[model samples]
Target: MHIGITGASGFLAQQIVRDALAHGHRVIPFSRRKGEPVTGCEPVRTFGPDIDLSGIEAIIHLAGESVLGLWTKQKRERILRSRIDGTRWIVDAIGKAPSRPSVLVSASGAAIYGNRGEETITESSATTSVGFLAEVANVWEAEGQKAEAAGTRYIPVRISLVFGKNGGAIPLIKNIFKSGLGGKLGSGKQWMSWIHLADIAALFLHALETESVHGPVNGASPNPIRNEEFTKVMGEILKRPTLFAAPEFALRLLPANEASLLLDSLRLIPEKAVQTGFSFRFPELRAALSDVLA
Candidate 1:
């Protein structure tokens, strides 16, 4: 399999490329910026013809700006534009290709379901959250739908908070812990769905090969833990005493009301992943944390 991936420099994207190559698949990295070359593929910009994705077996679209920044109006616009605009370029490229790729494995988010409180969301759940990220995720999923309409097998991977050593939410939380300020937010009982970066990268390979899994798929662990549980386990893993807590008011001082997302809860289950027989490498929070910490 010669996989063509966008955002090859991104944390998740890079992991996908590495896993693809390690599995004996060649990867063609599609990028808008100049990045260190990937081992199995050539790096080409969105407009360049140097790499033709038509020849590749699959396309994993992950190119987008980081969404964790302070949500100023300008920052929010950039977050939405990066995914919506970047996806348009990818769709256009796929349309013009002489031979369309067999599988289009694109990224989506658990955030698409928005803050459902105690509602356990599946792929079919309707998203009614009125926020910038909710809207961006909706548009992001639509971009991949275009490829599906074009007769390509499309898989929209809606990933949850991926916790790993170097990147994603865990490192930031680890840093806060290292700084002696690690604790839970809000009531700490808000449900938080998370996945190990290892499990996330592996899902790309699973979805790439598994014909049973397509359309919108959840990339979270089947076990969804509360924020308090997460804080406790993380504190244990790092051998630090978890003591402090940040209230909702403190977070509300930040931009875009994104603090609500941090403080709110969503209990997401990987129903499709489990039903389709895709087992998680790190199902429990402690095990996942230990593996990443180790």
Candidate 2:
């Protein structure tokens, strides 16, 4: 299969591209910037008009602005527009293509489930949260749905926090622990849904290859850990003591929307992925972190 990926330069997308190539699939990478070129793929700039979508069997749309920093009004618009406008462009290009692709595996987030306290959420769960990021995810998935109208099998992957050694949230958290400042955030009761980098990449491939899988798929591991437990695991893995804790008030100092990324609780479960026979390489938090750190 020939796969086209948006945001191919991104951390998770790079892994997906590598895996796709390993599996003998041709990749055409599209990005917002002209970065170092991918060796086996042509880097396309599609922020402007008309990108060629011909001969691509599948598309994994992952391009979006980073939602990690301070969410000022300007930053908030960029966060929302990047996903909404970027996806719109991709959907339009796919619609106008000489031939439509077989599948459209677009990126969404587990944040859509919002702060559902202790409730374990599946793909069937309602997106009831009205938080800023949750709203962004809702709109993002809606844009991906437009491809289904064009006869393309659209699968919106609601991804959780991705953990890897060099990238994703693991490195940043590891650094804090390494510096002896890692500890629980707020009440430390928030549930964090996370997936290994390898698992996420494999899941994208699974979505592309699996015919019966469609609609929203939860891209997460089966085990969801609480914030306190996650912090303790990080400390234990790094052979460091987690004595320091960040108070809720200190976190509130960040832009309210940005802080919500940390404070919000969501126990996301990948029911659809598991039901579709996709196996996670690192289903447990300790093993996943150990693999990355190794």
Best by lDDT: 2
All candidates: TM-score = 0.94, 0.96
Q: Give lDDT: candidate 1, residue 268.
A: 83
Q: Residue 166 in model 1: shift from native, Å?
A: 1.1
Residue 54 lDDT in model 2?
Answer: 81
lDDT of 1 by residue, 173-195 (tens): 78898777989998898999999
lDDT by residue (tens digit), candidate 2, 86-107: 8888789888988889899988
Q: Please list the C-alpha lDDT of all candidates, in the order they appear.
A: 0.81, 0.88
Q: Which 10 consecutive residues of model 1 have the lowest summed lDDT?
A: 43-52
Model 1 Cα displacement at 110 (Å)? 0.7
Worst 10 residues of 2 by lDDT: 42-51
The parts of candidate 2 lying over 4 Å away from their true place are 42-47
24 in model 1: Cα distance from truth in Å? 1.8
RMSD of candidate 1 to the truth, in angstroms, is 1.9
